[model samples]
Target chain A: QQQVKQSPQSLIVQKGGISIINCAYENTAFDYFPWYQQFPGKGPALLIAIRPDVSEKKEGRFTISFNKSAKQFSLHIMDSQPGDSATYFCAASMEASYDKVIFGPGTSLSVIP
Target chain B: DAGITQSPRHKVTETGTPVTLRCHQTENHRYMYWYRQDPGHGLRLIHYSYGVKDTDKGEVSDGYSVSRSKTEDFLLTLESATSSQTSVYFCAISRVTRGEQYFGPGTRLTVT
Candidate 1:
């Protein structure tokens, strides 16, 4: 079973537009949610993370809006740029374990210039 | 990015052969993980080590085996390679308490 489910296997957005990707989970035990970005031929890098206590977290043009009760979360990249084109993955983890993280399938986002 | 390196960044082998991939960490983190990334699937954990000589299997460990003799190195081995095992493998290290795992560049393995 996919503990965390992500939608829109692929997406395309023009530059300066708002790009959105959504994710939902079935495990309420997950307390930490993180988004990772990966480029071709490279490993994934941490983009942003949010805790259950906060409804939304933003860093620069990237934002993560989390809904604890809904067991859902979404990633928003504002003013999207071509450089932002990459595969984005959403992951969930609970502190109860010693850092065991479960990742979502991933969303391929393409930002047009 | 943490100081993590995956040896033999790329490898190709025939079916029924044995292949081993190594993950080394300079960060000296207590926890290390081995994961596989495929085209349509997210990264799936093959195995993980909490400390030297202490390891555990992850969700997908059927065709793989792992070992950690020291805190700095973790190894994943495929007893008998198969075409289905061809994929990109990644290693990550982290401090258990922090829950922030750092990943390595990754290794591309092909089993023909």
Candidate 2:
């Protein structure tokens, strides 16, 4: 069973437009939700992360909105750029076992100029 | 980006052969993980180690084995390579204090 589920296997947005990707998890034990970005032929890098304590987190143009009650979270990119196009993965992990992170099916986003 | 390295970035092997991928980390983190990335399945955990000589299986541990004899080195071995095992494998490390995990460049294995 996939612990975390992500929607919109792929996405496309125009330059300077908003891009959004959503994810949901079934396990309530998960407390840490993080988003990772990966470029072609490269390793994934941490983009933004949010704990259940917070409703939202914003880092630069990347924002992660989390709904603790709904067991869902979404990533919003303000003014999406062509360089921002990449595969995004959402992950969930429990505080008790922080090492075990479960990832969702990635969303491939492309920004057309 | 952490101090993690995967050897033999790309490999092409015949089926039924034995293959091993090595993961070395300078981060000295207590936790190390092996994950395989497929086209539609995303990244699935194969195995993980918490300490030297301690390891555990993950969701897709079948047809694969792992060993960690030292804190910095983790090894994933395919007892007998299969065509289905052809995928990109990644290594990751995590610290207890830090709630984030860092990934290393992947190793692409192709079974022909």
Candidate 3:
């Protein structure tokens, strides 16, 4: 069973446009949600993260909007740049599980100039 | 960037052979994880260790085994490599269970 699910296996946006990727989870126990970005042939790096205590978090042009009640979260990139094109993964974890994360399928984003 | 390194960055092996990938970290993190990345499937946990000589299976532990005998070293072994086991393997570490994880560059394995 895929406890965490993500939509739009792929996406494309023009430079300076907004890019969005959505994710959902069925496990209510999940309390920690994080997003990771990966470039070709490299490891995925932490882009941003959010806890259930907050409805939204912003870091630079990256923003994570979380809806705990809806069991969903989305990543919004303002002013998307060609360099921002890469794969994004959304993950969820809880303290009960020792914080072992369950990652979503992932979304491939392409920013064209 | 996390002082994590994976050895044998690329390998080609025959089916039914045995293979091992190593993950080494210098951050002295308390938790280490082994994950395999495949097309369409994303990254799936194979195993994880919280301390030396202590390890646990993850969702896809079949056909694989792991050992963590030192604070900086974690090993993933394929008892018998299979074609399906060919994928990019990644190692991740975190200072605490709930903290952000730092991932290794990844190792790509191909089985014939």
Candidate 4:
């Protein structure tokens, strides 16, 4: 069984547009949610994260809107740029065992210049 | 890459052969993990070590084994390789169990 599920295996957006990706989880034990950005031939890097305590978290043009009650979360990229084109993964982990993160399939985003 | 290096970034081995992938860290972190990345599967944890001589299995540990003799090194070995095991492997490090982790570039293994 997949602990976390992500939608829209791929997406395309024009420059200066808003790009959205969604994720849902079945495990309530997960308290930490993180998004990672990966480029070809490189390891994934942490993009943004959020906790259940807050409904929304933003950093620069990237934002994570979390809905604890709905067991869902989504990533938003405002003013999307070509550099933001990459594979994004949504992950969840229990606070006690954070290293054992459960990841969603992934979303491949392409931002047109 | 969080001072982490994985040896034999790309390797091709015949079935029934044994293969070992090494993950070394200079960050001296307390946690090291071995994971496999496959298409449509995202990443699945194979094993993790909390400290030297301390380790535990993750979600997918059936065909793999791990060893952490020193704080800086974590090794994953496949006693008998199989085509089903062909995938990209990644090593990650974290200072604490619930903290953020840094991943290595990855090792692409092909079993023919």
lDDT of each: 0.90, 0.90, 0.91, 0.90
lDDT of the structure predicted as candidate 4: 0.90
Q: Per-residue CA lDDT of candidate 1, range B7-109, in tens?
A: 9999999999999999999878988989899977899989988889998988899989999998899999999999999999999987654446789999999
On residues B1-112, what C-alpha lDDT tens digit does candidate 4 reach at each position?
Answer: 5899999899999999999999999989988999899888888999999899999999989889999999999999999999999999999997653536689999999999
- Any residue pairs clashing in model 3, and if so which? none
Which model is ahead, 3 or 4, in terms of DockQ? 3
**After best superposition, candidate 4 residue B92: deviation in angstroms?**
0.1
Error of 1 at B57 (Å): 0.6
Q: Would you list the clashing residue pairs of candidate 1?
A: none
Model 4 docking category: medium
Instruction: Give me the runs in candidate 2 sitting further than 4 Å from their true place.
Output: B97-99
| Count of clashing residue pairs in every prediction | 0, 0, 0, 0
Name the docking class for model 1: medium
Could you give the C-alpha RMSD of every candidate to the true structure, in order shown?
A: 1.2, 1.3, 1.1, 1.2
Q: What is the per-residue lDDT of model 2 for residues A3-113, given as tens digits with 9 covering 90 to 100?
A: 799988999999999999999998888888889999999888888999999999999999999998899999999999999999999999876873458888899999999
Give per-residue CA lDDT, model 3, range B51-90, as digits (tens): 9998999989999999999999999999999999999999
Q: Give me the displacement of residue B20 in model 2, in angstroms.
A: 0.4
- Per residue, candidate 2 scores C-alpha lDDT tens digits across B1-112 of 5899999899999999999999999978888999999987888989988899989998899999999999999999999999999999999988762347788999999999
